[model samples]
Each structure stands twice: as structure tokens, then as C-alpha cells.
Target: MVVIAKQNVVDILLMEAFYEMHQVRDRLNFFQEKYQQTFENFSVFMKKENENFEYFDDYMEWKAYTKLFDEVLKKIEELKNGNFQIALTALR
Candidate 1:
């Protein structure tokens, strides 16, 4: 397992979710699907979870806030829908 520095992880939360968002978007685009709506929904959920915690909360706390300690259903939902272009754009 790789250990991400606490600070770097925070930066990701603030910005790097693009990678994850792209991962989800790419998977959706692959199947030629119709779930762009799903990504919006999951993004909403992720926002809510993050809202519960501080933006720069400690690593463990931020993970918990993001529900990373839980099922991470939002990420799954986004990935399942497939909209790689959106995900990629988010990264940039």
C-alpha cells in the first residue's frame, strides 16, 4: 500500500478528484451508455459527504468525510455511467 502524504491527499480532495472523475467518465463512455445523469447524482453525493467534514480535515477524517471509509458508492456511480470526456476535462 502506498502512503500519500497528508497534505497531498488534501490537495487531491481540493483538486485531484479529476483522476477519479475521469476514471468514471471513461468507463461510462466505453459501453456507449446513457448514464450521464448518474455522474451528476454521484457528484452530488460526494459533495454532501465532503460537506460534513472540513476541507482540510486530517487524512483519516477527510477519508471518513468522503465516505472513503465506506462503500464509495459515488465513485462507483460515476464510473458506472461512463463520461470519460467530462472526467478528463475535470482533471484539466
Candidate 2:
């Protein structure tokens, strides 16, 4: 078989890079929307389900939500704070 041209290889690699970039951008946007929606939904659920907030005293439940919010909201904050590179690095 004949070897491929360097120019041809570069063209193929460039196309692949653009395609991958589009995919990553789309995926990132999707998760950003989904995360906001899911958090708002569950927040509403929690408020409606727990009228008195008595559950706040429960270490098991409190720690669970605390951990979840810390992980999710921290990244959101970092992204908003112009530390998106850090957030992306952390994501990786």
C-alpha cells in the first residue's frame, strides 16, 4: 500500500479536532443546563417535603446534601468566578 501524504494526514487530524471540540462543547452545555434543572427540582422537592426543616439536624441527611451541593455548586461557582480553567481541570 502507498503511504498517505502529510497534508492529507493534517487535514484529517484538523477535521477530527473540530468534531471533537463541537462534541465537548455540546456535552458541556447540556450538563450545565441539566445540573441547574436537577438542583432546582430537588431543592423544590426538599422544601415541599420538609416543611419545618427538622431534617437539618440529622447528620446523615444533612451531610448527604451538603456533600452533594459542595461538589456540584463549587464547580458552578468556580466556573462563574472566571476560574473555568480550574473547573475544567478539576473535571478532568
Candidate 3:
């Protein structure tokens, strides 16, 4: 049996959150490079042009990544600010 302190748990959560954020950012960067523009700009361009199936598919994926990136950033911020009780509670 092993005992883990609360601060240790928080530190682990912060590390995991940072890792997730990095992954999400990488995905966002891939989309940005593929489109040669930010998601918002690509979205606007898509709206102004005839809908191409490939672009549409990429758009959906890019949108999802964009949202996930934001969510991950928020999680990292919360963990950094010591608002990780919810995470610890859920682990119980």
C-alpha cells in the first residue's frame, strides 16, 4: 500500500494538465499550418466559398481541436491556481 499526499496529487494533476494542453496545442498548430490561417479565418473563408467536402471535414476537425485547446488551457489554468479539488474528489 502507498500513501500519496494531497500536494503530490495536485502536482500530478498539474503535470497531466500541462501535457494535455501541449497535445491540444500541437493539434491546433497542425490545423493552422494546413489551412495557412487561423481557425477563425478558415471558417470565414469556408463560409464565403462553395462548400468543398474535404474542407468541410477539415473544418469540423479543426473546430473540435480549437475548442479542445481552449478547454485544456482552462484546465491548466485551474490546476495552476490550485483549484484541483474536483479532480482529486473524482479520483476517490
Ten-residue segment with the worst summed lDDT in candidate 2? Answer: 83-92
Better of 1 and 3 by TM-score: 3
Residue pairs that clash (backbone atoms under 3 angstroms), model 3: none
Show where candidate 1 strays beyond 4 Å. Answer: 1-9, 33-92
lDDT of 3 at 90: 38
The runs of at least 3 residues in candidate 2 whose Cα sits more than 4 Å from the true structure, single-residue gaps closed, are 36-92
**Can you rank all candidates by TM-score, best first?**
3, 2, 1
Error of 3 at 23 (Å): 1.3
- Quality of model 1 by C-alpha lDDT: 0.44
In candidate 3, position 84 carries an lDDT of: 62
**How many clashes (backbone N, Cα, C below 3 Å) per candidate?**
6, 0, 0
The CA lDDT of each predicted structure is 0.44, 0.49, 0.84
Task: Say which candidate scores most in lDDT.
Answer: 3
lDDT digits (tens) for residues 1-92 of candidate 2: 46666556545555665565555455544544644544345455556665455533332343454455455555544434545321122333
Tens-digit lDDT string for candidate 3 (1-92): 57788788778888887888788888889989988999989989999878589999889898998888888888878877877664334344
TM-score of each candidate? 0.25, 0.35, 0.83
**Span of ten consecutive residues with least summed lDDT in model 1:** 83-92
Query: Which tens-of-lDDT digit does each residue in 19-74 have in candidate 1?
Result: 55565445545322432344335455556675544323333333343444123445
